[model samples]
Target: MTKKSETGSTKSETKSKSEIRNWAPINEIANDVRAGKITALSNVEKSIGLIEKHSEFDAIISVLDEPAKKRAKQIDARVNNGEKAGRLAGVPFIAKDNFLVFGGETTAASNILKGFEAPYQATVINKLEAEGAICIAKANLDAFAHGSSTENSDFFVTKNPIDKTRVPGGSSGGSAAATALSLAPFSLGTDTGGSIRQPASFCNVVGFKPTYGLVSRSGVVAMASSLDVIGPITKSTEDAALIMDVIAGKDKLDMTMIDRDILAYTKFNNNLTGVKIGVEKEYMDEKVDKEVKQIISVAIEKLKNAGALVAEVSLPSSKLGLPAYYIISLAELSSNLSRYDGQRFGYSYPDAKNLDESYMLSRDIGFGDEAKRRIMIGTYVLSSGYYDAYYKKAQIVRTKIINESREAFSKFDFLIGPTTPTAAFKIGEKSQDPLQMYLSDLLTVSANLDGGPAISIPAGFAGSLPVGLHIMAPQGEDRKLLGIANGFEELSK
Candidate 1:
């Protein structure tokens, strides 16, 4: 039940089950909080209450009950005092566990750092919190964001909110699942090689991966540093855009941050006149499931009906993206993971006799199977004899992919494709075959390799599950891409 003040006036009425289930978008809640129609405290209580109700999904790693309540009360006091509570005032959200957040551990779903507390907060988190958005919990992810299926998480597999038996799309699976189940209006996830968009597709929510360097990565856990970009998974493309305004910009800590004039993305233009969209030729291949293909085809037709000029385009280098992405990503991952040697950071082995043995035993006991496999593959590729053959070759291939993507963007305003080849698969379905699991990201990784912006929106459903329509735009065209995605998202409805 919603609470009232001692003055005998109701603070706010409780939201209906349908409204809560559908999740009132960010703007709606923020407006209510600002207008005093709803107290920030009430919003926090409701969010925490709903998360408890849906606890069976195992989507969250830890809850920030005390801090969230304290923040909400602070926001409520500001509102009562006739002060602005910031743009996102009183909107409760979730951060992927990989982000360094205070008041809780930043485990990244790995046992090696299970008890490690973050000394500070991620830039994105501080930005969101500054705008009065409350982070009530941390969502789970693959250990070190290494695997595509969240099953590699050292803690526990995050269940897809749609189908408990099916796997949520990973490395950002928990964030996507939390958004899908309406645990929050929006959630943060890091996209490196389709981590955000894939899970967004599986969960039938909107997931956006901005152009690399658009969002600052300061204070976030390193995972393939060059490939990692932070983005949002929200109930609507508009919500994602609203969040972009707060978090997207140059940061002093991350030298790679870009300075560009970004438009107000929430104000979408429905007119698609003169807009040319390319349908990636390879995305229509028979490898995609029949139902997923049909759904994507229908979504493309919606854009066409809205006066978008749709045509087929070929990017021959697209097929090489997945393998090249894995090589480059694993290589970077090996270097990033090398810091956890049990000398002064992460989990330490108590029974080791010597320093070398300590390094060996600590990593073996701390990292999960998927993480170990990637490390081994990475170490081998970057080895002295093989470095020139594999690591250097992968970089050359990456440049080719980026150049091809840029050339395509010269002719087309955006590229259209299916986010995933299929819907959420049953848990343990592809766990034994790592290769099969890797194929799940085949359609969504190119954007990451090319450092472009991409978004996944609910298109249509196959059977009881939903499919996503993936859209891509050239690097630094994030605002334009979000506008196109929002327009297409509206067309689907």
Candidate 2:
């Protein structure tokens, strides 16, 4: 286990001054607050200050300073009264713009829903609030969560905290950037393919994508329903586990949720002596950058050092994951996005001659170029004659991908890989090339295709950029996967 330190120690005494109190884990922050060392209101103010200081990243789309302060006061009052607040009492967190929260607009970083107000909070938001966690801000994301980089966001692109010129991987770029810069203790992000993990890797934070049905998706804006998942991005694996414990469970509003015994995920951080980790041969191929491969090799060595057996494995079908994911996701996107047709909600063109014209005009004007491209591609793939050839065939390919992953896991406790080919690319590097943007997710799409749980943890640094190593498990094996990650985390440190 990683060594624990006393709260509020001076930077000079800590092993690394830069790692002192800035990105302290949620549990440590909670302990200090409960012990009267730090006030909830003070923490909120600190976060506000950090947000202001790092405005260049454009990570926060909107800050709910007033409401967050009021909530912090309430938490302090409850603590003073000696009443139990909950697991995350007084902890501040941000949610990706796609999650509906009360204090500000949930824009999804898209012009179409730029000023849209949500009538209710997402189930995850409500659950977190019940645990006394404050929503301090809404983080930016790719417009409507449609792109691999936040550059597609109609509002603004979030820059990497480590290097301002490099992109903070997306569509969860803002969430990852916010967590990395200590703008918030933790943030919630959505993943369809590699949205959460890739950005988390790029920003050098812990990002988790729970099993497809493990978390409720009731109030999150629909992207691709089959592959979409809501998860946490935080500074440490344990913090991610803590957030998951609070937000995960079966929800009646989401029928896809399955009934399972809830466990404190952090309790699984015991030794992973008997775990079997599969190192995919395809992931270590020549296509991967040398530095990224070195990072993954180091992480695998850490796992092996922690007493886990490491073995070479193959998922030949994984090569088709990106294409299959795009074909299937676009088909779903075309259907889910049809709801913003100028009549029900979102921006509407005022000068249209008729309803159809209004719908077409508004969409054409509101959506960014990347969004339009995906929609058009989706429309083409789902058209009558091509649906069977592209969409249907992709679904079949998806089944093969899922089967291969499942069979591979039968002999292994988890699968490991380089979260991305390298590190964060420069903003606009791949935005113009649709194929290049799609390939960025080559390493992450298979987990979504198989509907399993996966996490990206900072392995180490490559040059100045960060590299993330992914650990994945079969669906519903979240606790085991988290346990193995926690163990590896200890070894790496």
Candidate 3:
């Protein structure tokens, strides 16, 4: 089908309104809003409609209807007054519940934070709002962002939009599910391991994980201080780039963020001539689903045909990447979570007999099994007797993984792989086996362990489920990674 373009010309508008309403490109929506073809209020209304229409997915924790309506009116008023409303003008978006946004609670999908309202907004949310974007909802995730599937969420399990019976990958599952269902053009998600990319793969959206510290983490509920990175989940790589422009920068509050060149990610050229790409051997383990592997193989062929050189490389240290990631992440999680002792903030037990009982009762009643498991694991690893054997050793292995990744980057511009070993599995399929659940992040944890950037783009389908081609680059090379991903995305189309 052909639709009228902004230039009064006809262009292939293959996706129907029903198909694209929730997942439309950022530029397309922004252009229409600027041209007065659509009002910000109408866009927000449509997003609200979709959120209600797909309520069964359990992808959202809360909707900001009142605030969203007010914000849209303000944007429309600005547009009518002949004032500029910033780049993202009227786009509607959702932030993972972990982000501290006004109009709703920031629970991180955990019960311990049941009624904790954020005093201020997260840095990323403020940046996006500055660009005229409206956040209309808060998406669900695993409690404290601990699990690989939304099943670990204290509230509800976020069902996959593609197949409702299957799990939407997590701990960022709700963000990916919302994007897939077109509830928003783009959604903010945090990736500590494969949290963003794995879910994007399952939902067939563009999930971007910037180099550690590229986006400020201030006001976000900390999971793993070192591994936690803020990023976006969008319908297209271009949308991801557009979002990166607004959110990728250093903030005084987050001193870990580094100053770097600002990239006009939307103006990328899709030429891969003479570019060298590496297929990480560790990520292609025999455990990967056969159908998913085949889809990735075809994607590599497309890149090769685009004038890129492909080679097989070994990152042997990556085999230990998962263990190291879990250890480090849990250790950080334990320390970060200690502040939630029920007395200061978050959920508190009213029937507690004493102060110690209050702390024990609140945490015991609030934390889900998964959260408890992780907290226990984290405490054990950080304990005096096991610190050297577990936590310290994991850190050493993490360093080795980073060094090995750097060595590979010297030979190739980026590393490519399947984002997840398999497509979305049936809900509760792996919930009983924590080891099996952890394996879902096998191919993705190395990038986090190395503190590098990675992206997941839709490669193709594995039967009815979608597979993602994972592309990763060295730390601070996010622009290069996105440019290459844009080329691959264009090629896939």
Candidate 4:
């Protein structure tokens, strides 16, 4: 069934949302479409052509060709009839594989869910559609979103858009690559730990993780209930802000969602004058690559010259964030993955004669190696006797990190660091070393632990690979974080 468009606005009915034409990517296409300068069908056609053109990148899993074309036609009809369209009218975007979106299977890149079609749409997807954004494709991700690289995807690893030899950062790797490849103006991604920001860093795009509970999580697959944040992978900060303005409001479907700020996120203050930024000293330690360090330092120096007060600050508990995140997220992952037994909507083992055998066989045959690894680890930590030793201790570490983050924010408006310790590594380089792979998120997981907002903007490259300048702000300060990020776009890149 075709998903319905939520609005039929005329030219005069369209609100003066923002002067989106000034933004080069997402809104430019939307403005032109509403003004009748270009048909929605024409943009959809171009986007389809690009998807086919870059099929080898493995960035996208399923293309919603028929439904997207149908929706585009509908938008063009409304525009032709002089009816108003929404803010993102006629714009196309991609969603990460795990989101429960219509038009294709919501597989999460794992065989266990290979044939799962969404019975309902994710809140973010619905919100975007209501604003007239069309989802043209589903992007690949680590199966069950269990790894730091798309290599964990049961089907195939997504290649970095800029350099096919390297891996796009996971588990939002495919979404990041799709945006960078220009398959769409923006794409949706989930950040638990650093899935969204790490990939965006590697692919030279912008990734924004809202303060926890700022965006509703309804209909999106849960990796870790407390940690998951739905966000956009976009070409620019302004475009991200525009998308957030539509999707950031509270939803009764998600009890955790908070009320969005009344001030429009689109009206961001990009002026950096007098902004106090804390450079994360821990992030610039010996383990960080010299070249990557240089890139981050250059960005800090640039900000300092722009009248921003910058100083080195420490969040030492952040050093333990990675280990804490793994224990917490995996425990939640194991619990969440429990519902995917053979009796449900996805793949089920046909040969099993007994109920217990069916459950054992289905999961054994269905989950990928990384998925199984996480499941075992998650279960191990949450087991009878080990719960206090592992899970409880991790939560203690998480709390310490949160307190440190709060203290850091009391003195500084935002924290700056390298999104990743290094630029994108070769596709197979860290695959065998789970420890190394887990380390990719060392710098980003702190924000999630703190339950605050964070973003990754393209910084200079480390050789051929693109790196991002990671920034963070305290809880409930998402709007200010977004504004500060918008200010550094030109200087960082």
TM-scores across all candidates?
Answer: 0.95, 0.95, 0.95, 0.94
Task: Report every candidate's CA lDDT.
Answer: 0.87, 0.87, 0.88, 0.87
At residue 341, candidate 3 shows an lDDT of 91
Candidate 1 vs. true structure, TM-score:
0.95
Residue 196 of model 3 has an lDDT of: 96
lDDT of 2 at 108: 91
Model 1 — which ten-residue stretch has the worst lDDT?
Answer: 1-10
Each candidate: how many clashes? Answer: 0, 0, 1, 4
How does residue 454 of candidate 3 score in lDDT?
Answer: 97
Pairs clashing in candidate 2? none
Tens-digit lDDT track for model 2 on 1-493?
1223223433321322243257577988888777767788988998899889878889989999999999999988888888777778889999999999997788899888978899988999999989888999999999989887798889888988777777899999999989888788899999999899999999888899999998999999999999999999988889989999999998888998975546677777548787888999998998799988987887788778778899999999899999999999998988899888877778888899998899999999888887788888989999999999999999999999989998999999899999999789998788779789888899999999999999998887776667898989999889888887787777767
Candidate 1 vs candidate 3: which has greater lDDT?
3
**Model 3 clash pairs?**
22-182
lDDT of 1 at 30: 93
* Candidate 3 to native Cα RMSD, angstroms: 4.5
lDDT, residue 394, model 3: 99
What is candidate 4's lDDT per residue for 1-493, written digit by digit as tens?
A: 0011123322311211111121247677889989998877877887888889878889999999999999999999999898988899999899999999888889999898998989999999999998888999999999988888899999999998767788989999999988887787789999999999999998878899998998989999899998999999988888889998999989999998778899999887878999999999899999788988988888898899988999999877778898999999999999999998989677799999999999999999998888788899999999999999999999999888888888888999999989999988998999998888998888999888888999999876666566799999988887788888888885543
Instruction: Give the candidate number with the greatest lDDT.
Output: 3
